[model samples]
Target: MNLFNLIKKDQEYWLVDQLKVSHIPNIEYLVAFDKLLTEWKEQRVAYLSLLMDEENEDWLLKRRFKKVSSIVEYTKVLDGSYIASNTFQVEALSDSRVTDSDFATLYDLCRSGSANKNKLFSIRQIMESLERELGANWRDQCFIFSQDSMNYGISIPHIEQDTTDEGRMFYFGVVPEQRCKGYGTKFHAISLELLKTLGAKLYVGSTDTSNKHMRRIFEANGCRLRDIKGIYRIDIEKEFIQ
Candidate 1:
């Protein structure tokens, strides 16, 4: 497979998807992957974040890459009968106008003390991402709360991802203050119903193995573990510039 097409480029990192092939990635695949890393180093890639199938997880050791997390893909079929028992004021984010404060708060709540905290994004970076996320074919960012209290948020995809099957939910996060209050359960249930409302036939979401809090929420919603993806990262090799 072509490594170039599998990457989603960003200012800080290039997010790669877990490649699932019928046959194991042989020596040629490793050579190509190493070559890609070499080229990325020369291009100042800085960090290479790889999402790989469990089958291919061991192969990265050949390149001295370390595993950061184990990502599990959870999926469930939507029956269109889901309903949220709890009432939450759901607000859709406006595409044309999102402020820095909005992103700063959300970023902190989502990443702080979590698996992705090390991979930080500034307020400007968050806003820049919002600009891309709210563009055409992108779904709405829905924030759930009650009585002006900010609880959490969930995002629905307006278009299918090339890496996964149709009808996907991009992400959901509970605020730091609201953690362990069963807010995630309520928000996740509401999200499932909302996804069904948005015509999602199958709901797919992922979380790292170490993120038991988020995994519990997914489990509460009856989401099953379908695949285990190995997450790997490597610093750019300055000496490999040649």
Candidate 2:
């Protein structure tokens, strides 16, 4: 059975499913993946990314998709066991009324780290993309945490809605100047509390294997290592542009 569905975001395509796509038989999954590629080509997709277990890397490599990175997924149950700092104030982006300055801050925070080279999005692009993915209430899910009137970072936490009470973060990062000051862990702790208010019974997070800092934050916050996956990417737009 085809356990996954192809999700399109602007010109990018994402293969999403409740379980790993590698769970299905190789032969069957291969045919499905091929069909997905054909659909992307026909739809003029600019990019596509798939996160699969290491066992599925060979086949993906054979399809000309580059192994960009390996990712580790972490999970934490929301039994109100996590504590957030009262010193920091939390403000939803929607409260800013979708102002240009707030979005500019979010853009800068998102691209502060040098880890991912694909931070090519403009401020307008970032705003438009989130609006499309999360709809009208997107601003409500986006948050900025501050202390003493200085913003520390941004977090976009969302629940799965009717499908599940599971929550995940679309983006989370500390500002460049504020890095290494223990704010990453503190911001994460606040994000967990926000998830609980959003009706999330559980929280799941993922980060690149090379990111020791994020991994440490996950561990420090009482999260367990759930699984690891390999990330594969095909940038048709870049290829065609070149």
Candidate 3:
């Protein structure tokens, strides 16, 4: 078994990547990995990525590193409507699912300058987020659909706390030309219904505070803002250098 570590540091930050471990069989390896991670933390490393074999037992320990004091606040939306009479036509993703060819149309309408402005949530970022946040459990939970031949989708991530009755809904772009119609509502309602059925008492989502159109949509659909979290990033190496 080969274990590979890639460590890169610059004036602004340090990145550590550990990949290609065949099998991690014991606490010794776990302690060693922890020690290495601690050393990085001591060095003020800002970001770390671990790529481990899914079959390895040591992977269980990876959850420990999530204890960084930093927090990424998502703008949470809560769903309060009673689910008695609303008929939401929700469709789950399947092997034979057919998507509209013009997903870009929806993307342009819903995303466009927003994606370009934030320098975040790029196509690649969205794909990576899906993999990390939803891919593991999506087989049983995700929903996808198109608004009038334009594809749009949402992925929900389960929250750890049940009392909040919350889940996260991530909206991928909608078909562009189909905007101003009720397609966005239809897509969102369907997702909400599915969440309700899955025992989600409240659903939350986030967007830039400046995004009035999206905020309005959420308001129109009976979603209320629960909290606002500020986003921040620190370059450990930069701080160290300073």
TM-score of each prediction = 0.77, 0.85, 0.53
lDDT, candidate 3, equals: 0.47
Q: Identify the runs in model 3 with alpha carbons over 4 angstroms from their true place.
A: 1-90, 98-110, 115-122, 147-149, 152-164
The TM-score measured for candidate 1 stands at 0.77
Tens digit of per-residue lDDT, candidate 3, span 18-57: 3323365544455665676566667665655443333333
Worst 10 residues of 1 by lDDT: 156-165
Assess candidate 3 and give its TM-score to the true structure: 0.53
Which lDDT tens digits does candidate 1 get at residues 88-206?
A: 76655544234447645665566566654235356466555654654543425544344355436544343244533345555567667767988878777777776665666788788
Q: Which candidate has the highest TM-score of all? A: 2
* Candidate with better lDDT, 2 vs 3: 2
The parts of candidate 1 lying over 4 Å away from their true place are: 1-5, 10-12, 21-42, 95-100, 115-120, 133-139, 148-158, 163-165, 238-242
The better candidate by lDDT, 1 or 2, is: 2
User: In model 2, where do residues sit more than 4 Å from their true spots?
Assistant: 10-18, 21-23, 117-122, 237-242
Error of 2 at 98 (Å): 7.6
